[model samples]
Target: MSDRHMICPPKHVAIIMDGNGRWAKARGLPRSMGHRKGVEAVRETVRAAGDLGISYLTLYAFSSENWSRPEAEVNDLMGLLKAFIRRDLAELHRENVRIRIIGDRTNLRGDIMPLLLEAEETTRNNTGITLLIAFNYGARDEMVRAMRRLAAEVAAGTMSPDDITPARVSASLDTSGIPDPDLILRTSGEERLSNFLLWQAAYSELMFLPELWPDFTRETLIHAIERFQRRERRFGGVTAPSLAVGS
Candidate 1:
């Protein structure tokens, strides 16, 4: 039998790429150096995901809380982000991957926001793997923003407050059109969601790895997929096959 027969693949795989700064510190290099190298890992993982037939890949690129870092480090990260978007847009388009940015972007630098919008516009219609970059994102903030918007409509009498539900909140989120993640992977051995995707990860299978984001290779990603395959995601039920029979 083939790997496909034994492994259950996730249609949407979300990753929290952590430990760039720590990785760099361990190497006696600047944190920005780690981020720059992490971009290479991003490229490799994207290719691997496409080859593995994974449809959606959401990466936690930057969080709103990250802004609290030193000004120089924050600027450097933003610079790296801008460079990645500009350098990788054409290649990503060539791979037929649709690029999307999900976050509270109102406070982003004007220059970077325009480039991000341009990148999204250029690859909006591609039909391959969807690469969602969560920049300046915080799950709590996302929910609050959605609630505020809905509350405004309800107060205006344009929408009924009683009609609001999880579906409505989901639709109001930045990731409205995308499906919830089936599996969530966090590297660098961290074992927390860290406000990545609150509502969207209600039933996601999670895997934590010790490898830092800069050191993540295609092999590492493939191994994660392989591990994900071994899990029996019951999703609160007992429909999975019996392990004794499969073994």
Candidate 2:
């Protein structure tokens, strides 16, 4: 590991990239401009994560609720997504960053689905940091979908209801192969999870930053990570007696 990553760095970091619209509004610019700038931040953060030796970085790019946005705004967001993949895919592949998508793909628009699939397929063999994009994703929806799959197994006599453990449920979710996030950061001073990774973030150290998504830079990411390293994660257990009480 590099000296820069010697701190107790998190193995997986998930970010809720928020406040793009607010960022644009504050600057008297169009929301599309904010979104475009946010994409640049995404590229920067990915490079920073790789440099820091972080294994997984999940980005909450778009939620299922975002579909309710105005038609033109939604179109703009989709166009940005397409443009990002087309422009950055080869570079990401060359950098050995594997792309993974964790979200509902059932009813995705025909044009958008192929781009997403291509990103995954092209980078499937990469050995570097895995970039998980949560598009059209909602925590509740993910849980419900996982439960439905388990329920079907029970009905089919392949698994018993009594065998339904937390591990089983986690394995059934869209993030089956991915590790749960060790830290979750939400930009724009948001202090809530906002329906993100509810099941997987049971013990994630959360950092709510005042910076908008478009303003998130490598330094901001490092600061959040340093904050996470300062936290003592007990994961429901108490620390050792020597470490528990203050001396």
Candidate 3:
């Protein structure tokens, strides 16, 4: 492989974009302004990831729990989503970015579903970076859905109970084709998974940054990548070579 291809960049990186509201409040601006700025950060991050050779970038866009927020906020968020797709779809397609969404579609607002579907269909054939958006997603809910599918298969006599395995379950997830993330980052000083990729993130390196989502820049992303590179990932095993030092 060429040096560019051999560079040790994570194959997949997932980010939880948090603290838009906090960022706006701190600046005495409307939350909507913060969300608007966050979109700019998203654009920059996507470009940086593609340039860095990261193959997959999954962003936690909106959780299912976010529906419980005030109706006005939800409407504004939905509007932003629609605007993003309408405005950026052509650019993303030209850049060869494949868009994928992982979340329940049932009961979605009539107009919203079509936009999400359009984004996926338009970029389905792209071979460049895959941008997986976790909209209306919850990790526990995803697990339950996967388990239910497995149970149905077993009940139909097509598969036995013992035939179920971790691999099978993973294949049933919305992210079946995508590789698991090597790094999962959350901004704004929060340090929790917040129900994102619970099964796939079993071994992901976590990074929590103090910078809010709107303030995240390319440098911040580079720093996070540097931090990840400095760590040793043993995948639940000790480093064999290191163990021989004292012998």
Give a tens-digit lDDT track for model 3, residues 1-247: 2223434689999999998999999999999999999999999999888888899999999999999999888899999888999999999999999999998878998598899999999999999999999999999999999999999999999999998999999999989978899999999999999999999999999999999999998778888988999999999988877687685
Error of 2 at 169 (Å): 0.5
Mind giving the per-residue lDDT tens digits that candidate 2 earns over 1-247?
A: 3335455568999999998999999999999999999999999999989988899999998999999999999999999999999999999999999999998999887689999999999999999999999999999999999999999999999999999999999999889988999999999997999889999999888889999999999889888888888888899997778766664
Q: Least accurate stretch of 10 residues (summed lDDT) in model 3?
A: 1-10
What lDDT would candidate 2 get against the real structure? 0.92
Model 1 earns a TM-score of 0.91
Greater lDDT among 1 and 2 belongs to: 2
**What is the TM-score of each predicted model, taking all chains together?**
0.91, 0.95, 0.95
TM-score of candidate 3 on Cα atoms, chains taken together = 0.95
Ranking of predictions according to lDDT: 2, 3, 1
Each model's lDDT? 0.89, 0.92, 0.92
Output candidate 2 Cα RMSD.
2.3
Supply the TM-score for candidate 2: 0.95
